[model samples]
Target: MANTKAKAPPIIDFAPFYGTDPTARQDLVAQVRAACLDKGFFQIINHSVPATLQDAMFTLAHEFFALPIEEKLKVDANLNDYHRGYETFRSQAFSGSLRPDFKESIDFGPDYQPDHRYVQAKHAACGPNLYPASVTNPAAFRTTVDTYLAAALGLANDVLRVLALGLGLQEGYFEGFATDPVATVKMLYYPSQEPVAGEGGDDGERGINAHTDFGFVTLLMQDDVGGLQVFDNDTDSWLDVTPIKHAYVVNLGDCTQRMTNDRYRSGLHQVINRSGRTRYSIACFHAGDPEYVVRCLPRGIGGEGGEEKYPPVSVNDYLTERTKDSYIRAEALNAT
Candidate 1:
């Protein structure tokens, strides 16, 4: 048992977490600066979520997914007024240049009251959740999710502070924008499937297609089943983002990249299910409200916006445009 656990997924070694020396954090700041400038991605240690919590979330999410297809489909997105509920792997057709993510996901945005259900032309968020009375352990599931989400909030807040330090801003520079942000945690499951070439297509037809995150920051806790890959902007290559014990990988989103005026970067990558076994992960996104307008960051020391390559626009418009392109081009079609 020990050997098997030892051989499990390889954890990411973040440069910021080497020693316990108090001043060591200064070095972490420097590391974060360099990482955000180059890749806008990093792995974190000492997150509030314990390893046990991570393990439990994965187990419960997978158990929920193992239900019959018909049972799971009962909570389909279209059925519920809100887009909450179960989504099949291929349904998204991300970018339409490859296969839909082989993994099925349960997506739930922030819950709201009927009177407060809002859909501004400038935002993509609104409405309530589509809960399936069918989930046998709904109470346990809610508790597990609530705990993980709280941890996510805590960690995201810390990361935002670190990002401020990285950007040479006061610690709370991003605090205002963090107000009532649209944070989401999607539980996903990728059942063991045939290898790509062994099955069909060079990239696994059933796995997640290449795409960049759309919010401020996206964090993922993945199982040992290794399939996640990240685009290395420095090398222009795709490398597997190894999962680390007691760590979760965090990446920048388009909205943030835009707001930072290119000081940060968003990456594009895909997953291939050659692991030949089932896998599970929880992806948490800390995104701005859709109505939020993204403009160039204050271009002082680390800021650069010579006329602002990207026009000031609401993330809602940007995401809607992107989503339309995603559906139109369809999978395996040229990227927008």
Candidate 2:
């Protein structure tokens, strides 16, 4: 994390979003709109996800990462085609110019069966997830992850409703986009690092490189050991995303920006763990339905407007292209 004294992003009380009061809900919508326009990042407090569940998820993350590399590889993501399961450290370079990220991760998504429509249609990200049977209490790990995923997706949906209203559209405007969504629940482990010694080392190596997310929105739960930083386009500097107790750090993604013709900023961000201890975070990337065509909305263009900045694209194609670009870099590095 940056110095504790540094400026922090806005933290909104999300309870109002679910309340019966229309005024309170609109107030939240305005706050969210401002945050998205200004920084593309904000923190949400008083969310409905249980603290106990969050704690359990973190516990599983710790336990899973502590296992020997051999054991972790049993559920390697490469085993499947849908990009689920374990990813080794230095396996990705989000910025393309920097060294590969120094973090390990495990990803899980909605486990659709072979007969399911999306699976049958061969949607790029739809398939059964790879669960690590090698973990102690494997059943607990699976159950905890599934339980938290459902809760996180619910919260993401509520946030989407707020976003729709914020854009001057109906609250249900985004509901259709969310059907049979492509939600990824990922656990990231950033190992402690010693400062780099040579030229460019100060900013070259990273736990994860600078990049905007690829989906509709990201809801992240990070532990106290924080190294997350959001880029400030105004100052051309990075601002640390400080950890907040029991709050999710929500941010917009490229797909959302495209759908809104850049009305919602999907800002750049990266992680660098200098805390001298491991850092854990759970990020749920909600990309909505694979088949939904992402087109600019009338409200997103505004009355004073210019022409649409992006052409129509399906959620599946966009996500697949981005994921393919990322792994291509990883594969190049792996071969060296």
Candidate 3:
């Protein structure tokens, strides 16, 4: 949350993700994997989603927020057991010490299956999305948002494949856990830029309070205005991370960290809106299937003989705790 002018990454043309570019793509994959192992984050280019789609999404977001406060309140997130709808300023809480991120967000993801055994119980944090049926352009709105989600999900698949390969496993080593994963996409709009309005000298006091991602990985499309910062494990500095044109900002989540036994770090990421420019970002969260147990891998362990490293747990248990911190409940982690 400190006001610091950080250098933006040198802009690079994205040749890696485009078709028929094998060498470049492989190199791209290698770089991302390396970054994931070291810092657990990277900016990617050439994973294309049409400019038209991005534009429409922004347009609809504007209209959605412009609706009368009364109507917006009707869909406020607190009303539902599943927290997948309109969130007014200060609704969602962050880790202790930061002011509520000065923003409002619309969160949604793939619908849950009707036969999903635990739909009524496990997914109190998963529910129907809030959409204004009275929008001016529903067609353009749905198409663009859906396209953005699909694109991010596809990119996630590619990254997971590379990760499996990068880890010396068959390509689909991670695929078995991905069935009907609890994918989430959130649209964030930080308040209009203003002088830092809150007390400083403490953490979590910015437009975006700092926290590590909770799912497997997160793919984000941010506007040109820079505010994203990532903790640098090597430098011990919270370096500024700006969006590169045609690039997606990617980072590992806490679950990935636990599963990997810290092989990958789920570094802290935060956004500052100092430019006074309203920022728009579409972030997609990738998760494992609800039933997938996210225990440690054989290779991730290092026992007394330096053989293995971690205790076993399921992805479902990990993710549920991540989203609601109530999966095992506070008493469970605290039990004697």
Best by lDDT: 2
Instruction: Predict model 1's lDDT versus the native.
Output: 0.70
Per-residue lDDT over 32-129 for candidate 1, one digit per residue giving the tens place of the 0 to 100 score: 66667766777776666678888888877877788888988888876743356788766666754455556788876666546662533224544566
Number of clashes recorded per candidate: 11, 0, 12
lDDT of 2: 0.88
- List candidate 1 stretches off by more than 4 Å: 1-22, 117-123, 196-206, 301-305, 328-336
lDDT of 3 by residue, 173-240 (tens): 77887656778888887765456556753434466666788778888878777788887655567788
RMSD of 1: 6.2
**Superior candidate under lDDT, 1 versus 2:** 2
Candidate 1's TM-score reads: 0.85
The lDDT per prediction is 0.70, 0.88, 0.67
Write one digit per residue (lDDT tens) for candidate 2, span 87-191: 998777764545778899999999888899999988877889888998889988899999999999999999998888788778888899786799999999999
Work out the TM-score per prediction: 0.85, 0.94, 0.83
The candidate with the higher lDDT, 2 or 3, is 2
Winner on lDDT (1 vs 3): 1
TM-score of 2: 0.94
